[model samples]
Target: MTDKRDFAHIETWVFDLDNTLYPHHVNLWQQVDARIGDFVATYLKVTPDEAFKIQKDYYRRYGTTMRGMMTEHGVRADDYLKYVHAIDHSPLEPNPAMGAAIERLPGRKLILTNGSCEHASNVLARLGIADHFEAVFDIIAAELEPKPSPQTYRRFLDLHNVDPTKAAMFEDLARNLVVPHDLGMTTVLVVPDGVKDVVREDWELEGRDAGHVDHVTDDLTGFLQGLLAKG
Candidate 1:
């Protein structure tokens, strides 16, 4: 657990779409991961093993593998998005509790994801919370710039007219929260529950004392419920 902070001033709730909205154990990313590796392999004419390495390298360097592809090989964003997000979304169960909690929160709710809007829509629909969000600020909306990039965050805020001081950003990756924190938004990191020996990706791991993070939780629905309770 991380230090908790007051969120009463937050009026715009910005949520990341993937692990932040759904639990990590669902392993949905595994499907997308393989697809991305396959795409990279096909594009570069490399072995799957080599493609996997490239995928991680790109993710580390460019915030997203697709961004790397676009920058390096001029791959079409739409084509890559269509290919990677074709996986089944049944792993996500409909979360009515989360929907209700989000509905109870005051002001606007928005999704800010490094993924495509189409992918975000599918996940939100599967969770039965698609209608709860006012709008989705996706990779395309950010002009291919991904999270943790100050430019991407700036674009989202400008397009949506969101006030950083009155916003709260929820994300699974701690590194992604740094820019949001610096911009005056409350930052929350969502981790898996009761997992003592969890294996994390290099990007997912962050120091607990990092001042950018304000709160941490495993249960997103319950966390939002608690926030609403405080009000």
Candidate 2:
């Protein structure tokens, strides 16, 4: 691990919502994934298999499936977001330990996600850590733009009045950290534990060099705890 003191100047903590905050094994995103596939299948009159391919293709091309759908097919963003996020959040167990770790961190905490604010709110509430964050910057807030897009990052920083040099961003996808790293923020990649055999999409895989990532950790709570200890 890089010395935690390296992050000593981070006065703002920006976190991605889905797999970064919750373990991937919890499969919370599976519900949203299936819903996206179903939406694509229904809208395009294609089989689920074909829709799955299209979903991923759009995700790769547009940073998000919804953005691709809107750009190509004129899909309504609000309805699509509501439909895809309408899933049971019961898989996310309340995490007091994680909450405590987050609380111990010094800084303004913000959730930066490509998902809807309502979805972020639901997930935070399910985790029992709703009150920990100062604000959530969601897809709508980004004007339908998504991460890995420099424009989205720029807007987020402007909306929150955050200085990238004084921020640390944690995300499950390494690609999403590229802009943050370029902006001078400390970037941490959060991967699932014991993921040797787990299948992931191309975008989910970390690059060989992973030069954009300053740190890697499987346990976000533990990582935060260590940061506090070192601080």
Candidate 3:
């Protein structure tokens, strides 16, 4: 763990809502991931395998698969978001420890996600930590833009009136932390802890040593609690 003193200046704790907040071991996002592929396959009338290729391609090229489709094929963003996020969230049990850890933070909390607003809401509600965050900045809020893009991060910072120098961002994807780091926010990469039992992409596991990440943790709740302890 990085010294908690490193986080003493942080006044805004920004978090990504997916695998970052909740442990990815639960595989809640795998359902959404599958749904994305399902949406792509059906919408494009292609095989599932082909959809898989396209989904990864679009995600790598355009920040999000839906955004790629929107840019190239004029796909309806609303339809795509709704369809892909239509998953049962009952598997997400509440983590009171995490709630307590978050509640003990020194300042405001916000969620910045590439996912939809409703999806972020559902996940937080299911985790029983919805009330901790001040607001959620979703894809639509970014005007259908996704993270790793400097523009989208700027929009979120402006919308929330956040000072990047005093903020800290936590995300599961290493690539998503780049712009935040560049903009002077302390960047944290939340990893999967070598739990290969869950569905995940190899590329998703890349880039911890690329220097954009200031801290990395496989156990978010524990990490947060440790921060408090050290602080």
Candidate 4:
């Protein structure tokens, strides 16, 4: 556990919406991922097998598959965002305890997701934490550039007037925390609870040791509650 002193100066809590806010076990993101594959196959006129390879290759190369597709294929960002986000959000169950913990924290809360604002909203609403956040900085707001991109982080900071030194960022992907850490924000990596290999990919789980993550927790609800206790 990270000491309260580590985050004592934080005034803005920026959380990644997908696995950071909601438990990864909820599996809501699997739906969006499937849709991404579907989009790739349909748009590229490629076989499903080929699309899978392309999807991952693009994701690895561009930080996000959507960014890669746009760069190489000139796909409309809105169309892709809308298509990918149009999925059932029922897998997310409300976590009133976590929401309460978040609400009790000092200062404003915001969501910074590689996902769309609509998707973030749906996830937040489903988790019953939408009201706790002051605003959302999504891929659209990021101009289709995703996290880990220094420019995207800078754009988010500029848009929100957030001082990195006074902010803390929580993300499920270790890679996404690099820029925030570089900018002086406290970065907490939210890991999946129990049997991670079953729920996450090898690549997504590879960056825990790159020296950027400041804290880690598998239990988001307990971690937030613990932060409240630390303070």
RMSD per candidate (Å) reads: 2.2, 2.1, 2.1, 2.1
lDDT of 3 by residue, 113-146 (tens): 9998899999998888999999999999999889
Instruction: Name the lDDT of candidate 2.
Output: 0.90
* Predicted candidate 4 versus true structure: per-residue lDDT over 54-159, tens digit per residue: 9999998999999999999999999999998899998788889998999999998998889988888788888888899899999989988898799999999999
Judge candidate 2 at residue 114 and give its lDDT: 97
Query: Model 3 off-target regions past 4 Å?
Result: 1-5
lDDT of 1 by residue, 128-225 (tens): 99999999999999998888799999999999999999999999898898899888899898987856444458557564457888988899999999
TM-score of candidate 2 to 2 decimals: 0.95
Residue 174 error for model 1, in Å? Answer: 0.8
lDDT against the true structure, per candidate, is: 0.89, 0.90, 0.90, 0.87
Q: Estimate candidate 4's RMSD in Å.
A: 2.1
Superposition TM-score, candidate 4 onto the true structure: 0.95
Top model number, TM-score: 3
- Each candidate structure's TM-score, on Cα atoms with residue i matched to residue i, is 0.94, 0.95, 0.96, 0.95
Clashes of each: 0, 0, 0, 0
Worst 10 residues of 3 by lDDT: 1-10
lDDT of 2 by residue, 1-231 (tens): 443326888899999999989987887888998999999999999999999989999999999999999999999999899999999999799999999988878989999999999999999999999899999999999999899899999999999999999999999999899899889999898987875344467658665247788888888999999988888
Pairs of colliding residues, candidate 1: none
